[model samples]
Target chain A: MSKQFDNVSVVAKANVYFDGAVTSRTVLFADGSKKTLGIMMPGEYEFGTDSKEIMEIQSGELRVLLPGETEWKEIVGEGEFTVPANSKFKLEVRKVTDYICSYLP
Target chain B: MSKQFDNVSVVAKANVYFDGAVTSRTVLFADGSKKTLGIMMPGEYEFGTDSKEIMEIQSGELRVLLPGETEWKEIVGEGEFTVPANSKFKLEVRKVTDYICSYLP
Candidate 1:
């Protein structure tokens, strides 16, 4: 379920992964929900998640390799995808990509 | 000169500084104007710019010490400040900060 949230208070921590290829800042809501908004540079990166995540692309393009998929799919310009909990996904960033990841509890 | 541009094409290069305390993705325009949009973690950071920059804060708060200034001033939520070219400024991030830095030519 994709829904828009407003007035999110950001968490003052940054998560840097893959040698700084991707950097994310956490946003905290008053309802205890969490989201991470970040930008990914042009590179191939693999990410693991502890909870189910809905990744919404804000800008640029991403060639993503979802779990159990053999071919990578390109997502661009406000496209979004879901990744299940305890799984991983690989992304080949063709350009500078901006994304928002919402954690579903 | 604070202005907004639309449909910015993002460059694929990421400039990581301060051991990944700050990360920025380059956004290149068609006319060669560039901007970097990124997030700064909660820490004290010093940044030097080659050209004049107008830093627009999107969220959170920042305490900044401009060049030649002895005291740090607090800027919060949608506020902005300008830094002269070839100068440096120090920022104490009291929270996670998202900013868009526009380069003036």
Candidate 2:
């Protein structure tokens, strides 16, 4: 379900699942989008640059890799960080993880 | 986090917890609100009539009690239903449950 706002739109409800390895669809917004992303495990996954503009892991363990960066940055679990638009990132899921992400428009 | 829209507003992210028996704040919107509510257990909850205008359970188990009603209606897990504004509802959680509730404005 979706709700429209003056400057933002919310996908009110969604049930997303990822197996051992799965690539999510590249979510794009007019300018950006905001969402609550939850990883049900602690493991690793890669996020492409074409993904959302901004990503914030509200809760869970995640490792992020910026565009042109070779090493993964621990963003959650151990610490937290923000990812800029057009930047490539990856997440290392160590266990069942759940987080919230928002893409700015 | 919140984002503004032309006709609606979005509470982008929230982490709500129900400790077996707890009553949530009566969420009120200007005209309405949209939210995804999850019950992390299979039990029951009583939603007062002063709650949001509309509620939709996207997943998991839920039992609803309408205002002035003496019985509860199962809305999820086994079936699904919608709650109108100013209506009183209750949820019966039977197990570890998680469901999304959208409040429409």
Candidate 3:
């Protein structure tokens, strides 16, 4: 993938969650799709998604429990996971994580 | 200020600092100017600058001690500060702060 998103609009403010432990900036594409580039500090967080979210982890270590999954999935360095819409997932972020979340339409 | 930056390029990777206590996304303008949108968690941090920087705090509270200054400048809600090139500054972040930092040419 390209290292940079070109010709896009970026919101000035951040979407903060878990008392700033998880923060993201929204990037708006010309095709009306949006993605969030986010950082996750070492912490445990549960998130509910309104849309189908494909999370691409760029770096760091973490374990994820997707909705209705029986086992926890671990990713070190770089990986990805998908979550269904209107579902919740759990994350055990073992290190500082950089991720890009694309909300699929 | 405009709530969003249009027709800009955003690097996919984030700039992580202080073990994830500070993180930022770089936005590249068409005119070669660049800015960083960042989040600062509650903590104390000392930073040194290579070029002149204009820091606009969009939210949260913090106190800053600029280089060659004795007084601590406090900003609650929203405010801004400037740091000269090759100078060092300290910040006491009392709350989670969202900031947009511009590098002056």
Candidate 4:
């Protein structure tokens, strides 16, 4: 579904990682909360977080192995999963995937 | 550079396009303006728009043929370009490119 935002100011610079396997941009609003909007291509990735992160899958699919979990979980477009603070997680990408990371204090 | 938003809400659903070549998510704020965060992979693509669009290149590179321009221009990470309303443009992607489209009223 299409979404609407009241107002948003995008940061001028972008974040690039892993030889273009991942890229992200930061969006700033009038308030204080922050988020990173990014995309991931087909690859295996491990991510560590300082704070709790809400990983919202915007498109494609991800097979995730959360911290301490033996089974890999599938997350499709429009689906979301959360990682605990100071935790690490792994993702096995089968296809191109888009995502948004909302950090919680 | 990383970005910060005061308060923002992400629309649950994601926008997927072109067989995973592109995908995006909508973000909503308390006010009303809207934005689509997305990424594009390596390929040639043509895009048409109704409203004026500010395409920000977050990562990788893009060779663009703007409306009426016979020569292609390169826009790299942290670069941007504008497309007029009721216009079309072509992009020759040499690498994975991430972008954000801000639609202007």
Candidate 5:
């Protein structure tokens, strides 16, 4: 799938796939550029961020880990949630899952 | 939860929420506009399109319905699939599901 942004330039696009395992990738983008990331999986995964941000889980199950928090919280299915930037957090994926994540500067 | 496209304009954005049943929405976009849709769900959902298009299921389980085909084919999580534009199709949502769907013109 492809998307074009007339209002903002796309810094990066990725297809993340996991099969009941943990996978992590360090993301780097151009300064002042908004980044959109999508992860498609059939299991569970976790996402961590170092900055304040917004996260949308487009499918499956996800858990959010907050800074200084040892355990994760269930955000339920659908809807939207916010992660404070520069704060470390993790996205745990449960069951077979997929995600489309975008970041705006 | 929000995205800005500098190379294209957003024609519409909607938040789709589902809890285990089938849910669908008819989409209309401006001419020459590219639409980006995201479905954030926890179970399974199916999506159909009339024109030949690309679909990315960001998580969970999804089945694809082909024209003249009575049964749906399982498209595993965390990848992309295509549907021919102008063709009628259905999105069968299974389990506790959510989806983010976008159309580009």
Candidate 6:
């Protein structure tokens, strides 16, 4: 929602996955909360979550198959979705997607 | 280099270049300095710098050709290079590269 996050710590190293098709920078907050700002290249990806995740898509087009959902949800530009903990979801990303994923315990 | 940068601001959006093959998150410091923590997927890329740039390679295999250079310099794992302002450089990346680029005024 905000343009930038202030007074935080960012890890220099990125969390690279899918052979660099997906990459994120870890940002730590003062409240001990952790978030990842990431980029996902256009591809199909399935991800499992350890904690509840709130994914805010900043730009791009994509279809998501959330856990326990039979139908795929489409987001053309900006959107948000929540995934349950210990759940798996599928994404058919059609464009370069920029997202912020917030982890909740 | 430090493992992390503390007490900083991070832009939520990513700067995507070369059709998302190169993407970076902008990190802002208190002293008006700027840096970009970025990843480059295996490919060839040419970039021009507006200000002097100090590129620290955290990990990767790549060859760089700075402006006015005839030979391509190789970096196997970790290395550092500087490009003068308004200069162009070429990169032949063999592996996914994680780098921190500091922009100096």
Task: Please tell me which predicted candidate would have the highest lDDT against the true structure.
Answer: 3
Task: Give the winner by DockQ: 3 or 6.
Answer: 3
What residue runs in model 4 are displaced by over 4 Å at the alpha carbon? Answer: A1-12, A27-32, A76-79, B1-14, B24-37, B56-59, B76-80, B98-105
lDDT of 3 at B95: 98
* Order by lDDT, highest first: 3, 6, 4, 1, 2, 5
Q: Give the per-residue Cα lDDT of candidate 5 at A66.
A: 70
Alpha carbon RMSD to native, model 2: 7.9
TM-score of each prediction: 0.53, 0.46, 0.98, 0.70, 0.40, 0.97
Whole-model Cα lDDT per candidate?
Answer: 0.74, 0.46, 0.97, 0.75, 0.45, 0.96
Candidate 5 lDDT over residue span A1-105, tens digit each: 233233434311222233313221112233553434343333444456655666665555767677777777775556456776666666665533333345644
Deviation of model 6 at B17, angstroms: 0.6
Q: What lDDT does candidate 5 reach at residue B44?
A: 41
Q: Candidate 2: where are CA atoms >4 Å away?
A: A1-7, A19-41, A49-52, A59-61, A66-68, A76-89, A94-105, B1-6, B16-28, B32-34, B37-55, B59-78, B81-105
The predicted structure with the larger TM-score, 2 or 4, is 4
The per-residue C-alpha lDDT of model 4 at residue A95 equals 77
Q: TM-score order of candidates, best first?
A: 3, 6, 4, 1, 2, 5
Please tell me which model should have the higher lDDT, number 4 or number 6. 6
The alpha-carbon lDDT assigned to residue A40 of candidate 5 equals 34
Best by DockQ: 3
Residue pairs clashing in model 3 are none
- lDDT score, residue A37, model 6? 97
Higher-DockQ candidate of 5 and 6: 6
Please provide, for model 4 over B1-103, each residue's C-alpha lDDT reduced to its tens digit, 9 standing for 90 to 100.
3653435565544566676576666655556665677767788989899999998777777799999999999987668899999999999988777677788
What ranges in model 3 sit over 4 Å off? none
Q: lDDT: which is higher, 1 or 3?
A: 3
Q: Is the docking of candidate 3 incorrect, acceptable, medium or high quality?
A: medium
The clash numbers for all candidates, in the given order, read 0, 56, 0, 11, 54, 0
Model 6 chain A: lowest-lDDT 10 consecutive positions: A1-10
lDDT of 6 by residue, B1-105 (tens): 559999999999999999899999999999999999999999999999999999999998999999999999999889999999999999999999999999999
Q: After aligning candidate 3 to the native by TM-score, how far in Å is the CA of A46 from where it should be?
A: 0.9
Q: Give candidate 3's chain B TM-score.
A: 0.97
* CA shift of A69, model 4, Å: 2.3
Model 3 TM-score? Answer: 0.98
